[model samples]
Target chain A: MASLIAWRLVAAPHPASLEDYPRPPAPAALRLTTLGDPRAGALFWMLWLQTFDDQAGVTASFKKMDFAHLTAWLERILALDPGSEYPLLMATRVYGAVLDPGRQRLMIDFVGRAFRDAPERRWQWQALAAVQARHGLGDRQLALTLVEELEQRVPARQLPFWVRGLHVIILREGNEIEAAKRLMELMARDGGLTERQRQAVEMWRERLEELR
Target chain B: MHHSRQHRGQAPSRLSAVAILAVLTLRMALRERLARAMALMIALCWAATWFLASLLVSDETGPQAAMLGFLLRLGSVFLTIVTVTFSLTRDLQNRGLEMMLALPYPRGVIWLGKGVGFSLIASLLAILDVLALLPLAPPGQALLWGVAINAELWLMATLAMLLSLALRQAPLALTMTVALYLLGRSMHSLLLIARQSAEIAAEHWSAVVAQQLLTVISWLLPDLERFTVTDWLLHHGGSLTALAPILTETALYLALLIAVGHLELRRRAF
Candidate 1:
């Protein structure tokens, strides 16, 4: 019993959260290292990235995170399981929520590239990212660029009118009233919108006129 | 004419002996708490899967399905290896094998009985695993995953029995079985790495030799990567055509292990 007590005192373990972010291996190398089960491997790392701070019962501050290194991991994970939206969701919601403007911009840019890969499927994250840029980072230019890219890559007909008119709203926010009115006019002329969408567009046009 | 009739009568009795021994093997395992252990493990695995599912950000069930499939398959393989090997090695350590050999049944019947008994246990585990998966995965995909898990566990069980009998020590035999399984699972990835490295450094003869050695080893070992794929549960239901090679490799390997085990058993003077 004395020996056991002595051993316990000496072996008192201090568990610490992982604070340092390491760059992830290339996708091909990671696939090889995981014994070729890319799906499981990708998921394991994604979970690790998601819960790394609280792993040892300690919460590492988000400011401690190296967004560049973290972005690399997200990219590699998405490369491994391209169909998965978990990584992008993390980038837009969790990492993008960091108070550091530079890190927030980093996540927004990562979401932009990821969105380009599968525009139809990943447009939601891109949309969230644009909102983050405009509101969170207060970078209107970055927000406008993202909205333009989303408009170009995803077809206006495929999107609901409200989503299609995101750029017009951004333009109005930037005080480009003439451009916003012109774009809204063009959107109202389209015949493909649902009754609900057309009504939403009319509301937006009236609001823009009131603002002007 | 009298000799021929005697032989005919003995054949049926010998076959019956194998069947009886198989039943006895299963009963012994049950008495050793195999069922209870398997149930506990399954419950724990499912609970963990449920907890992890809530943490996933994706709206689709693919990640959850993949996780359940992976956990169940891994747990079954680990449990089968430990149970089969430890049971056989215990019999060997306690001189139970000698007592059994003193019985009237031939040595070959004893080996077949134990092998089939382990295979039956594997089937039960597979069925339970698939049932656990049904909530997360489509039924058709779950069934395919179940079949592959069964085949993979069958291979593990047979290999465990053979190694335990040959080595007659639980620790050594278990280690060897696990090592072989890990090698088989990673052989495809190892081969790819070797190929890439060799191509990158063509002037290095060591890389070429390493690649060739891995190729030969891969051919000798079962390609375990083809079995129990999580992708099958995540995507479209797996086709029967894809299962063909896995089943074939399992059957062929089981035959080879049985033949080798039989010869080893017969040659030993116990």
Candidate 2:
């Protein structure tokens, strides 16, 4: 027993990424039937995903994951319980922080697609995805496109005016002076902005006039 | 006239026999160190959940409580199966079971007595689970989860006892009980799948027949889909009124399993 313990302490194992592991295809109906509760099934797989550390350690870093498989799993889990915010949270906050631009875009796109399905419950993730597009990926065009969709698609009353006015700010940053001025005028005319938002809009319109 | 009077006299004797046998079963489980084993399991489960909770990046209370509830439920089911099956198998091996059956008391006295004993053991396991889960979940939700889990474990215990009496071997009874428990837990999903398939392909006879067969199996098996729900402990949304169907199903299944076990015992020649 002493020799075995000494040997175990001396030996080292090879480090492996989470990509080395095989991802199971978890269909929603089968999981719901087998586990009998969607929340329980979703929680089990969510916990299982944390077990794949490259080293013999406590938690796996999202940087080491295969984004394709991770996106597929997040999709399947969201199908099981659409109301669950954990999957979306992981997409935007955890996996979105990876250094790889391609993987970051994949996470952003997954969040975007999920938002389209339940915009009322998930607009914040979409907003974060737009921010990632602009700042992280250095793609202002994609950010402008996403922010425009949010403005047009989501119900106005469900979100605050600041969220709704994000497209104008993006357009202004992109130097679309005429379009930004038009959107702010339309927003002010619509009579939905709060007093503070209206004041900010007026100040921004004056700034845009000088830039033009 | 004499047989009828003897039947009347047997009632009180049978009651006393049941009480005596129940006490004996509890003693046997105590000798098997059930409480110590269950306590160890509860501690291990609590530690594991606490470690998992620490790994979460977001607010961890709800998911942690859900995971703890799930692990405790699984542990209780496994312990109940092992204790009930192995204890009965030991009694059968030592001829104690046959000796009891040879007496004038009806076989049900022996069956109910042992069933009630195992139910007590199940209650003990549930109580340990509740205490372990108390700090993680709300007290009301935790208590409800404990009662629901106790009902689930009691159903499993009665089923395990029936399987042991019928199969007469430790390994066989244990295997059959686990298989049946898995089947019962997943049967609801199978029925739903079959129904969907039938609707999609109404002209296909295979789908229709499969639906019919699963319907029969669902009827014969205990519907365990709602047993020990984690949502109750997580405060997602469940009330005390929701336990009515689970309790009713458990009582019905327990009575049926005990009756069938008694009939099986009567048919044995020993």
Candidate 3:
């Protein structure tokens, strides 16, 4: 999972140019267009381009290339598409994976900007909540707001059970254990929790008691 | 003339039987809203793939790969829920068992026929969904082979239906079905947990029993996770070679469940 997260982060369209990197022969004739979906096809190519550039930067950090040249490459890519969702989401996701306090703040800013621009997008709301939870933003106030908004917008019957699970997680993180417990009970009443989920909840309850 | 009329009113001819069964299953499936729900689910999955694809940057190596991974993991779970709730539950509610028994056909034959019919429907849906997802997948033959992986999920649904018939309670049946799904997905993790727990608390019999139970359930239930080829499809561009073995195992499991269901139905007062 950690490696996967790193791959996504490094693959984001950095503002860096690929020319600084030593051009290795393309490994295969495979191109993204053959994969299908023009949108995804474009994204795949962009990811490859960014990955090559990022690797060049790493090499520069190791004194394989001029640091200024690598920096210029990064700046160029960033300049080309500063507002793209791909980089912002990838950066935020990678930031979450690393759990770095400073990087997390940067991720939150990116997600916030994305959300402000596209408030209707569920991904933006979810990403914002995730970052907010990690950063303890507004003491999880942002997380709560996003959850509430999602609940109101998403139909109760059609909502995925994971969303409700997220709400429970938020409540638990906010020191609302009793409320979380009550919510679980309500879900049980509504036949939402499967037998295993209920069992897992029981285990959680026991662990909570030990903590208390 | 009376004797000829009696023969005419008897069981349907083979051609008519096939046509009637096809129409009945399709019409009933549509009327119960299952068809609409499945269509909506497919649409949502396509939308999700598009959204995820759009998030990939030009320089990323694994964004498309990761999105595909996420979709398959999430899609498998959703498919299990939908299959069990919609297909299996509808059969139970509509007295499908009674209808089957009422027919002059052998009980086992009826069970096998219904199972095949439901499996076909599920497979068709799975194939359509995979085609819809093709555009978002990484370039490979493995991506195309991922279509067959959905058969495992359908097998689980068939098993769930048989179990529900045996249990005769929707809530309990649904709970068990979902539990089976979770167990199938997390079997390896649960086994590791059990092994670790056993070493830490060897004296606790309850813990030992829990571990044993989990291990048993993992093996007893269909391991739907084994059919997951999305990782290989998106990353390595390799076909799922385990398709034949998995299909055989699923068929065998379905046979056993249906046999058990047949026995239960045979003994049922109604």
Candidate 4:
């Protein structure tokens, strides 16, 4: 059984894109290392799984694992300790769609579920989910709904400016250039826009001008 | 007559006698195979904690916060239980306990000394756990829980001594000790559950009876929950004051267990 599991990990077909892989499988009990405390348990199991094949002759079976398995492992860890920040942060920083789309969406999906399971930094995570929704999965409606939920959940100041900018970008991509320009102009009214964010908003307004 | 040191020249002071037993118990633990395995296990657990901490994106000390506390509470408890129980049983089986009882010292002093000696092994492990977690946990909290785990182990050791005396076999004594520790830790919640169910059923008599039984048991058994603040210490830095109740209850339990063992020894034919 161990050999078969190892074989599956090594020979699993590469997902052509982020959309290719299905949702991760449920975790088996043997994989759990929880001893009552969730956060500590989650971190411990994640590290142990990462280093499972670190013996002298082992081929490092952990690296060859596909996103499906990785997500399953991560899902189990998150289930054990939903409040931990490791799942969202590690998924974003380590797994990106640019490198492997399948792995990227796996993390994005993980983060989206984590957004509901653990609401520690819900707005920030949902905003990241919005970016992934439009760019990674090509679901503009999902992106819009995520941004909407993000706006409602947090204070106005806490919402990232880039999240608002993504709203304009999503609007432009949806063929609502006029609405996008109006939103961009509304953002221009904000006194707190950093110098770089203000430059991005000006670029958006300029592009809308060219469209006119 | 042979057991009486008073006839020869002078009797050993109570302090020296206990000191001798303490050294003997420490030597027994040093010679025990389980102590070595326990050392390796503690090191491995810490290594795993260090690795887990490294995987965090921000490399914060938060992930490592519970490292030593968990080791002290869960891991060291089991190791100490096995070591203390097995040593006691070995002494009994080999007739070594008989020879010790034949000595001039009372069984109370001997058992207390042995408990103290067995507790040192746990103290050493707790220290190692603290040093491993030194970089991860706040120093004050680490030291506080370190002392807490030691006191907890001493309490457990005395309990093991009493269990071995009562059962006269290591395997059964160890099993019973483990069960008692688990039940003690969860006793508050279990009693609450029982009483809540009784209330739901409208069985006033059952609730009253359960409360009376729990009160009696509480008087005899230390509430193991007092030692279970690993989560509090992990999430919020703990202060020395946190140990007050735990230490008090642990000392009380230790004293009771020794007193009981001393009485049990007096009644025995040996």
- Candidate that would win on DockQ: 1
Every candidate's TM-score, chain A alone: 0.89, 0.84, 0.47, 0.62
Cα distance off (Å), candidate 4, residue A154: 1.6
Flag clash pairs in model 2: none
- How high is the lDDT of residue A133 in model 4? 73
In the range A1-212, model 4's lDDT, one tens digit per residue, is 99999999899575433222234433323222243344455666666655543444444332354667667767777765555666666666555344555656677777777776544465577777778778776778878877766666666666678778778888888888998988887788865889998998898899988876
Candidate 1 Cα outliers beyond 4 Å, as residue runs: A1-18, A25-29, A32-36, A55-58, A155-162, A175-192, A205-212, B1-17, B50-62, B93-109, B199-203, B234-241, B266-269
Question: Model 2 over residues A2-53: C-alpha lDDT tens digits?
Answer: 9999998888864543344356553636365435666667776776664554
Query: All candidates' TM-scores?
Result: 0.84, 0.82, 0.50, 0.67
What TM-score should be assigned to candidate 4? 0.67
The candidate maximizing TM-score is: 1
Q: Give the lowest summed-lDDT range of ten residues in model 2 chain B.
A: B4-13
Instruction: Provide the interface RMSD of candidate 2 in angstroms, 1 decimal place.
Output: 2.3
Clash count list over all predictions: 0, 0, 16, 1
Of candidate 3 chain B, the 10-residue stretch with the lowest lDDT total is: B57-66
lDDT of 1 by residue, A1-212 (tens): 99999999999577764766777875557777565467777787888889876746577888887888998989988887787788888988889999999889889989999999999989888988988998899888888899888888998777665566778778988899888888877787868777887788788888888987
Q: What is candidate 2's CA lDDT for residue A124?
A: 84
DockQ of each: 0.48, 0.44, 0.03, 0.13
- lDDT string for model 1 (B132-190, tens) is 88888888888988999999999999999999989998999999999999889888778
Q: For residues B124-191, what per-residue lDDT tens digits would candidate 2 score against the true structure?
A: 89998989888878888888888899999999998899899888899999999998888788776777
